[model samples]
Target: MPPIPIDNEGDPRLAAYTSIREKDLTSGHGARFIIEGKVTLETAVRRGRFALESIFIADSRIEPLAELLARVPADVPVYTAPQSVMDKVTGFPMHRGVLACGLKGEIPDPAAFLESGVSAASTLLLLSDLSNHDNIGACFRNAAAFGASAVLMDAQCCDPLYRKAIRVSSGSTLWLPYAQGGTGLDMVNAAKAAGYEVWAMTPRTDAASLTSLPVPARLAILLGAEGPGLPDEVIAACRAVRIPMSEGFDSVNVATAGAITLSHVFTAAV
Candidate 1:
């Protein structure tokens, strides 16, 4: 598809690209999400999992991204504007020179998602109350890297499709299968009913060291947000596992801790 020239920031065609920061912070434009950075845009285009509504690129980037842009469906609009105009539309310095608007489909039911590949899946992750976008994104990246079958998040976790989280994950959020929206207990019980042994991650003194525990055939590792960590009741519901740190250091970042545990469990299971 030939690039459509976009001289006016207020053009209805570019409505999805306007006030990106504000929209992302607030309602996230309903089911739509803004994809920033060339890598993320390329991932979204290549994966074709989500519906690509349109693309907005800086005029200077159009020529360089010509081959990639050609891959987009003809029906989808590809709008190009000067850097200044792009900045004005997005309300920021458009350093990446590429942005895309994608529509999210309905999230699958948690039980169905967990049961779909139960027999074949060895590992899964449950995120509880993780509000930080960067942490959520990093955790998704780690989950993808470690070969987790899917990620299930409780209602309180932040949206992985948030622009910053997507960028932080290097687009892994798009590649990974995930379902969110449920209470912590609801997620844990769903995994249990699907024949998975749920393990809650914590830094508590009584928790069994991760290295000391044997990985189960079907495992679900529950990770909580930073600071408050997992609630006592949630931890008590599952076998609590902790990473052993040096005497002086008590804990790592939630993403780092998740990666360490994932590596241990994935290696042991395989």
Candidate 2:
């Protein structure tokens, strides 16, 4: 189908793309979430699990992105607007000049999702109470980059499908099989029941150094938010491991720590 032309910022068809920053801060994108940039939009088209509702791009991008746009299913609407209108509509500069909206789809039962999505020897990342969108995005990127089979997040995590999170992830959240819901302990127990060797990532002195810990055939690394880290009971429920850091520095950014640990697991698995 030919691209639909959008001339005005108030075009009702572009309603989903308007005031993006405000929507992200408030009630959120609801059943639909926005995708940003060429690379992330490409990821959404090729590898994303969710269905694309429609695509909105700057008019100037039409020719440059022609080949990529050809890959989009013809049935999905593609809207093109002037760069000025695009910026006004989205409440941002519209630098990359591309966006898409995607359906959230039905969230599966967390336990069933793990049981069906993972193998007996799978590597997994379990997240708990991570409120930062960037950290959530980075975790998905790390999980995908390091060959983790799936990611499981507890009830308190920020939405990985949030616009900024999706962009920060470079769209990994679109492809990586992940389930978000349930309590932290519920996540741990689900992984344990699935026969995974659950490891709580913490900086506590009693935790074993990651370099010394053996990677199990089936491993789940659980990470919590930055400040409080994992709860004491949660840490006690599993094998505890810490990345060795220099004297007087026991911690790293949670996402950075996740990347380091996932790298260790990926290295061992290979």
Candidate 3:
């Protein structure tokens, strides 16, 4: 099966990639979202192993894409054109010659999510008000690397399936299970109801230190985005917890903090 080759900017096959030009990532006729650039492309394909629909490149990079060219399915479309056209359509000079789109999806319910983990698994990153795709994606990558069983984002958070998040996660977003539409409050209740101890990551004076908390058999670490921090009600909903930090700096980036917390939890208990 030879690859589907498309060269024209106006080609209908390029529809998904095209609307990105108009900044319409999607309007709901069902199109795979795209992540553009080399790092993201490599991550999306190899690490996340996302269900990629196709790859697009410019005429100038037939040789550059060689490493992945052979691996791409023969039936997947690969589009190329003069640098001028790709640049005009994409709104910038191309760097990767590799733009790929992937399917949108949701993971199963959290109970099923918990059941999928190894019996000895230890930690989960529970995200509440994470709105930035960059932060959410990085959190997933951090969770994956630090041995968190899974990453969970509240419905108020951005879709982990969004292109920016998928790329920021270095495709770890795809590798991890994600759910949508549930809120921070719902996550806390669910965590408690499921028998997993919930630790709301907050900097309040009385919060227990991450390393000092009685490590539980199953744990969910709740995180809020920076600036606003956790809502008072959300923080009050769980046993409060905080990461140890240097003097005068009582905080870490939510993603970095998640990594640190997960590292501690993973080694301490199931």
Question: What would the TM-score be for candidate 2 when compared with the true structure?
Answer: 0.95
The deviation in Å at residue 54 for candidate 2 is 0.4
Off by over 4 Å in 2: 25-30, 117-121
lDDT of 2 by residue, 205-257 (tens): 88899999878888999999999999988988899998999999999999999
Worst 10 residues of 1 by lDDT: 21-30
Colliding pairs, model 1: none
Give Cα-based local distance difference scores for all models. 0.87, 0.89, 0.72
Clash counts for the predictions, in order: 0, 0, 3
* After superposition, candidate 3 runs with Cα above 4 Å error: 1-5, 19-31, 47-49, 106-121, 267-270
Off by over 4 Å in 1: 25-30, 115-120
lDDT computed for candidate 1: 0.87
Expressed as tens digits, the lDDT of each residue in 71-136 for candidate 3 is: 666666677677766766577666666677776543444544555552234567789888888898
Best candidate, lDDT-wise? 2
RMSD after CA superposition, every candidate = 1.8, 1.8, 3.0
- Provide the global lDDT of candidate 3 against the true structure: 0.72
